[model samples]
Target: MKRTAALVALAAVPVLFLGVFFVLPVSGMVGLGLVSDGRFAPGEALEVLGRARVHRVLWFTVWAAALATAITLLLGIPAAYVLHRLDFPGRTVLRAAFMVPFVLPTVVVGIAFKHLFAGALAGLALDGTPVPIIAAMVFFNLAVVVRTVGTSWESLDPRPAEAAAALGAGGWRVFRTITLPALRTSIVSAATVVFLFCSTAFGIVLILGGLRYATIETEIYLLTTAHFDLPAAAALCLLQLFVVTLLLYAAHRARAAAPVPVERRAPGARRIRRTDLPAVLAAGVALVLIAFPVLDLVTGSLRHDGNWSLANYRALDQVGQGSLVEASVIEALVNSLRTAFDATWLALLIGGLVSVIVTRRSHSPTERRVRAGLDGFFMLPLGVSAVTLGFGFLITLDEPPVNFRDSPMLVPIAQALVALPLVVRTLAPVLAGIDDRQRQAAASLGASPLRTVLTIDLAVITRPLLAASGFAFAISLGEFGATSFLSRVDHPTLPVLIFRLLGTPGSHNYGMALAAAVVLAATTAAVMLLVERLRVPGVGGF
Candidate 1:
């Protein structure tokens, strides 16, 4: 009885928190759009479905996402193979450096890409085109494929492949027979994630595509803010939810069907083979392409009025940021840091509690399925996107019990909703992987359950917890879609301020935007690098 009570109490924390913050808000916003005059309208839905513009936007979104996913796979698969198969100088360093773009704020990426292709600094700018937008999606998504696929690729045993090769199998035949089948699961998982990200891309589409291009994401922003068509925005949100859910369901099925076998050998420690050279060289070129815009952003930040200058950064101390945004760059940074701190605490607290519940005593298949459902519940925020949360907050939080519409707390609450998934993903695996022997040993030594958890489980989970905290912080710092919509005018975040600065017309505004973007990117990279140093070998998605 006591044990059941404790489990229920532990589960209540995350359930209540997520229910109020994430579930209610999303339901409110999505529900309001699905109804007309408080009545369900099947005809309204059909009208939205039949609209020519809606179909156009939806189809374009599909085409763009498909093309972008294909490009990412073509680039990322060989890169993953190199990282998995070869030993080379600075290889780990190269891998870590390449990861910078993935964590970078989408707004900052848009800024860097715009300047590289459209600014006078590049001599041959490529702005206001689908090419730059697709390129930006590819830039941000390559790391996802490389990291996800590389993890599985590295652990694969080579004996089967070697035997097949020795038995008169050719290069392609050996790979087709052994390697391809083994890697299909990771490839599909990676590809699904990349496709989802590209499909829901916002800042890259907004900035690079100019005023003409519109995904369902950007259209929601346009309909809500620019055109004041709330109903249309809500309908678009529904359409987006439907598409994303179907894709997620498919990915889940694929992953469950193709389970990866455990490998007993150390990854990437095998003898180097001749075929690795091409993979290595391809990874090298990919790294250069990944690093170019970031390095160029740094250069642009320091170059003011055609010469090296600190004027752009120094002006961060003043109000308006040389734009009409009213907030200084320093203030924006402070707001972002503050939000990251609060959001990380909220996510870790709630996510850790939920993870404990999910990892708690479970023997039956029914119990395991319930735990899995709970896990997916926390992660629903990622699939739903921050834009939906922001919209939901506006629609739902004006009432008495949850009336935080005017408060600054909503900023990080939205961020926590987004960060909670990563926190759980980081901590749950470690928690579940805890050996039963350790706790049994502690109990044998007369340790209480509480003491055993503190001593054994806490010690093991601390580093991954810290890494999770760092990820939450980095994610909050770089968040743009929701922040742009939800943040208060006077208390804008760094990403929001950068977006505003980009809109103002002046050399100073442009330069300052570049400087702030570089600062944001650099800080995110620093956090990731620090966490990488602290991370253990087989933890969560770093």
Candidate 2:
């Protein structure tokens, strides 16, 4: 009964957050699309659905996402296997390297990818286009497999595959029958995540695509902010939302059907002698693919005008100074930092509160239901397209008792929404793992619930909370979809600045964008290193 009450209380936060910001706003946008003036009218939606341009864009979105997901799985599954199954020198470093892309801001990724695909990169013929854009998205999303499925794959017993080998099963046969089945759930989970990412990709598409292609996200941005077509944007966003929800449903089903005995194992294994060479080679290639864009950005940043110079770095503070209250580029960096910080705080507070409440009384019926509902609500933000949410906020925030049209709070608010799911997912596992005996012992010794929690639960959860908050901060820093719309013109975030730099013509502009990307990449690397530092010496930090 006590636990039930806590869950019910915990349920309130996500429910209210999602209802107002997610459900209501999204529903309103969809309704706005289907209604004409004050009544129901599906004509605009029909027209949008029937257009060849719309179909082409939708097809591009689906196929590009599919291609990206496919490539991620190909690269990720092998890397996950190696990471999960082998013990080697620099294993820790390799693991950390895999997470670099996820921590980096997407805007930084866009700039880096653009530079890597530059016409003169590494004496290779390069041009920023759809191929490079898709390649970058796949690289960025590979970490999803490493973190989600790789963790699970590491837990799987090697005995199953060994047993198959002992029975004269060939390598491919054993993998097809035994190893594959064991990983099916995780593969689905990771694939869905990759798909979701590619579908709503904003920064990469914006920079590398260069107006040649448009995903639903790009289309929505063009429709609303550029063309001022609210109904069309709403309709496009609703389509994206519906598709994403379907994918989320599929992910939920896969997760539920996964075997319940999922276990964690220490990362240790003797090298598979015959397979070691291939594994190492594969890992090398994957690392190069993942690391090249970053390297390109860094190298490109330092050298411009046929020689190495700090001119780009020096110019960062000067750009957009006269046009805005603050130097727009530097202001964007400051805005991104501030928003990331605020988003981290908000995510930690709300996510922590919800995690505690949900796990308080797991044995009670009310608590179970409430916890489930809250979990669903928390995950809603993950499934909802950030582009769709931005459009919704654009339309909704203008009207109502709280008109935040010109508010600086809007950027962080949207960023917090984007970071919420990552924070909750990261923290919930740690909270659930807290030993009940410690709390019980404290209570028996006459400690109050608050005191017991402070001394016991807080002690256990500190590292995870920090790591999770770091992830939240990283996501918010890199997030571009919503921030682009919500951020004030004068207070543009780093990504917004990067996008502007890329859009403008000139080698100087491009070089400066690359330099900023290098800075952003450094920030991402620092966050991951922090997360690595926080790992508890036993359980791997996801």
- How many clashes (backbone N, Cα, C below 3 Å) per candidate? 2, 1
Model 1 alpha-carbon drift over 4 Å, by segment: 120-125, 262-264, 270-273, 320-322, 363-373
Instruction: Please list all clashing residue pairs in model 2, or write none if there are none.
Output: 105-478
What TM-score do all the candidates reach, one by one? 0.95, 0.93
* Model 2 RMSD, rounded to 1 decimal: 2.6
Error of 1 at 404 (Å): 0.7
lDDT of 2: 0.78
lDDT of 2 at 317: 76
The candidate that achieves the highest TM-score relative to the unseen native structure: 1
TM-score of model 1 (CA atoms): 0.95
Tens-place lDDT digits, model 2, residues 1-542: 86666566656776776677778778779888999988999998878777787888899899999999998888888888787678778888888889888877778887777667664463555574578878889888888887777777777777777899999998889879887888888788789888988988987887777556889889888888778888888888778878888888888998888764345455466666675577566767788888877777777788879898987888777673223223446777788899889888977887788677656646856667767777666667776777778878888878767577777777787888888777777777777788888888999999998999899889888898888878888888888888877877667888777777777677777776777777777886898789877755434334
lDDT of 1 by residue, 130-183 (tens): 778888899999988888888777778888888998899998898787888888
Off by over 4 Å in 2: 1-14, 121-129, 258-267, 320-328, 362-364, 536-542
Superposition error at 345 for model 1 (Å): 0.7
